[model samples]
Target: MTPIGNLKPTIKIYDTTLRDGTQGEGVSLSADDKVKIALRLDKMGFHYIEGGWPGSNPKDMEFFDRIKKHQLKNAVITAFGSTCRPGVEPGQDANLKCLLDSGVKLATIFGKSWDFHVTKALNTTLEENLRMVEESVAFLKGNGLRVFFDAEHFFDGFKANEEYALAVLRAAVLGGAEAVILCDTNGGSMPFEIQQAVEQVAAELPGVELGIHAHNDSEMAVANSIMAVQAGVTQVQGTVNGLGERCGNANLCSIVPNLALKLGYTTIPRDNLSFLTELSRFVYEITNLNPVANQPFVGESAFAHKGGIHVSALMKEPGTYEHMDPASVGNVRRVLMSELSGLSNLLYKYKGLNLDKTSPEGRKVLEQLKKMEHKGYQFEAAEGSLELMLRKAMNGYREPFQLQSMRLILEVREQQPIHSEAVIKMRVGEEIVHTAAEGNGPVNALDNALRKALETIYPEVAALRLLDYKVRVLEEKAGTEAQVRVLIETGNGKETWGTVGVSTNIIEASWQALADSMAYGLLGEK
Candidate 1:
C-alpha cells in the first residue's frame, strides 16, 4: 500500500473541458469561448488548461491561434494530440508537428497503452507502439515543450497485460516525459482497480510525476480520481462538469472540493475554490447545457431545503441537512417556501420580512403562503410576490399603488400581426393616475401601462425592469382552458427577484405577477 501521506500535497488540476470535454453529447465550444474559459480557469488558479487538439479542426486551430492574445495569469495552456502513428517519424508526423506549432509551452500527448489497441486498432506490433510513445515524447521534449504523456487505456491495458502497460510508462519516462498519466479511457474500471493500477505504476515509474484521468461510465470518476491520489498520484485531469466522451471525465468541480475539504489534499488554492460554482455554471451556460441543480458543491440545489422536516431541522442545526456550508463553495442555501415548507421554512425564507414565526400574523402569512401554493402559486420560485404580500400584511406597510381598473384592447386582421394595447388606472396616495401604452403582447402592454402609471407617482419604478417571464400550465390536460402560472423575474438595478401569479386566464395570471413584480420593486411606498 502507498503511504497515503501528503508528500506532494498540492495536487495539480488539469482541465480538459476544452478538449476531452467537447466530445460529450450535446456540448460545443467555439474558439473565442475556449479562450474565455481558459482565462477564467487561469484566474481561479488552475494549473493546466488543455486548450484542444490543434490538429483536429479549424475551430480548435483557431482557439490555439487566438489564446496567445491574452496573458493567462496562472494556467499553463496545453496543446493536446496523440502520438505519431505507426511507421510515422515523430518529426514528420502532421499531428506531432501541430503540437509543436501550437505555440504553447506545454503539450499533452496520448499514446496507446493497450496491446489490444496495438494489434486491433493500430494493427501494429507491440514494439512499434513502444517506439511511437518513446519517439513522440522525446520529440516534443526536444522541442522545448514539457510533455505530459497520457497512456490511453492504461488501466484496461494494465488489467489485460500488466507487463506491457508498465512498459508504456517506462518508455515515456525513458523519453524524458515530465509527467505520466494513466487514463481509464473507457471509464469502466472500478475504484479499487484504479488504486491498484496507480500503485503498480508508481512502483515502476518511481520518482516520476504521476497523474490519473478517469471517465464516469461507472459513476466513479471522481471517486477513482481521489482514490488515485490516496494511492499517491500527484496530479488529476478532469473537466468542469465532467464533460467528455461516453459518461464524461471526472468532474473537477467535485474532485477539487473533495480533495481540499474532505481528504486534506490541496488543489486550486483553498481560497479560489469558492469560485467553483461560478466556474461550473459558466461552463454550463457557455455550453448551452442545463445545469444539474443537484450536482454536488456548486449546484443550485446542493444546499436547498424543501421538506418541512428538513427545513425545521436545519433551522435548529444546518448540519442536519447540509454536508458543508454552501457559502464555502460560493453556493447559497435556498429555503423554498412551498406547500412542503414548514414554519421553519417560512421563517427562514421570510426572515427579511421581519415577522415572528409564532405570531398570529406570521401564522397568517404561512397560511396565506400555503393557500397560494395550493392555488398553484409557487412561492418557491416566486419569493418576490410572497414577500410583497407578506410585508403588506404587516403593520406600517403602505400600498405602493392600488389598481382601480384596467382595460386591454386586442386587434387582429387578415395578413396583419395582432396588436395589443393597455390602459391602467391606479390610485397612488391622494391622486388617481391613468396611463396607456402598446406592447408586443398582452403582458408587455400591461407592464408598460402599469409602469407608465406608476413611474410618474414613484420615479423609483423606473429603476425596475422585467428580466424574464415564464408561464406554465397548471394542468396540461386542461389544454388551452387550463389554469396557468406566470413567474416573472424583475430586477431593481441592484438585484433581481421573482414574482408569481395564477389564473385560468393567461393574461390575468401575467397581470397579477406583473403587479406584484412592480410592488416588490417599489419596496416601501408609492
Candidate 2:
C-alpha cells in the first residue's frame, strides 16, 4: 500500500548557519570565515543560505558586500532581518531598506506572532503588529524580492490566541510572502503539538506554502520538523550543526539525511546528501566548536561500537545492531577496543589494523591492548596512535623519526617586579634543536616551544596548529594530585585529526599528545 503523501514527497532545505548559527553562544565568524563557509554550503547544494542580517552588524554587511563578486551556483543567498519596526512605515524603516538594497534576491523577515511579544516587546496593539507584518512583506514583494515570513513563536502564539496567530499568517500570505515559516521560537513544543498545530494551519490556509523553523530546547526540533512535514510543510529551516540561539535550532545535518533516506522525501539532491557529515564537521570547525560525538547519523561516535556482543553480531551482519549503514551518510563504522572488549572485539581491531586475526603475534597484540586498557589507556580516543602501536607490536612498524629526548623549562615573574621566560629542547634524529617562546600560560608555552623544535626538520608541521586542547582528571583521589587525560586536535591544510595522552602531570600529557599528532601526520604521509 502506498503511504499517504509519501509517493511524491518533497522538501526544501534552508540553511541559516551564517545568520542564526552565529547567534549560538561563543560563536562569531569573521567576514572572511563567513564567506568561506558560504562558498562551501553553496557547493554542497543547499537550496538557500541565510547570509546574515545585513544591517545588524558590520561583519554581516561586509560579508554581503564581498560576496557580490562571486557567482554562487545551486544556492540562493538570503539576507535575514525582522520586518519594519512597529509605528514605522516599511518604505522608511532603515532595516527594511538595508535588506532590500543588499542585492540579495531572497530575504527572510521575522514578525511577532505571539500577542505577548506584540503587546510587550513592540509596545503595540495587535492591529499594529498585523499592519507591520503586511506592510513589510508587501514592500519587499513589490521590490522584486522572494521573501519568507518567519512567524516567530507561531506554535506558542497559536496556543495563546488561535485567531491572532492565524491572523498573523494571513497577513503574511496576503502580503505575497513566498513562504510562511512557523517558528517554534522558544523551541518548547512537542512533536504531537507540532503536528496538530501544523495540520490545523495547513487545513485553514491551503493556498500558502508552509515552512518549519524549529529550535532544540526540548531536544525534539528535528522530530517536530518531520512531524510538520508529515502535516504538509514543504520547507525546513535549520543550522548546519544545530547551532543557533539558546539550545539551538534543528540540525540540518540530521534533518537532510533523515528526510531523504528514512522518510524518502526529496529535499537536497541525493549526491549532495552524502557530504552531510563532512559539511557538518566543516561548519563546526570554522565556528571553533567541537562536534557532539553522539549527534545522530553524522557524529564520530554515531557508528562507533565497543561491546563484545555487538561486535560479534556486527561481524556476521551489521544490521544486527546498526539502524543504517554508516556510509549512507559519509561516515565509517569504528570498532573500539577497551577493557569491555572480548576476543571478537580484538579480532575486529586486528582486522582494522590489517593484521591476520589468527596470527600468534596478533593474539599477543590483542592481549597487550587489553592489559593496557586495564591500566587506564583508552584506545578509543587515540585510534591513530593505537594503530601505530599495533604495527610496532607486530614488528612491521617503521619509525619516521626517533625522539632522543625533550626538555621544557618555564620561568615567570610579575612584570611589576620581575620577568619570566620558557624554553624547550628536543633531539630529533641525532640533531639537538632548541627553541624558546613566551606565553600567558604553561600549556601555551609548551605548545609553542615544541612546534618550534619540530619546524626545522618538518616544514609541513608549521601548517598544523592546535585547534583544541582538552583536559580531564582521571584520578582525583588526592585532590590536587591526580592523573589527567589530554586530548588535542591538530589540523593541517587538508584534514584534522585527534590524539590523546594521559599522565599525572598536565604538561606532560599535553606534550605527549602534541608529539603524537606531529608523528602521526608525518607517518601517515608515508
Q: Return the TM-score for each candidate structure.
A: 0.95, 0.81
Tens digit of lDDT per residue, candidate 1, span 1-526? 1223565579999999999999999998999898888999999999999999998888998998998998888889999999999999999999999988889998999999999999999999999999999999999999899999999999999999999999999999998899999899999999999988898788877899999999999999999999999898889999998999999999999999888887777688778977889999999989999999899999888998898899888988989988888887889998887777777777777776665656677677778888878888888778888887777778888877888998999999789889999988899877899889999988889989998888777888888989999989999998999999999999987899999889999988999999999888887554
What total of clashing residue pairs does each candidate reach? 0, 0
**Candidate 2 RMSD to the real structure:** 5.1
- Clash list (residue pairs), candidate 1: none
CA lDDT of every candidate: 0.89, 0.84
Model 1 alpha-carbon miss at residue 121, Å = 2.0
lDDT of 1 at 8: 51
Model 2 TM? 0.81
lDDT of 1: 0.89
Candidate 2 Cα outliers beyond 4 Å, as residue runs: 1-6, 352-364, 388-473, 479-481, 484-526
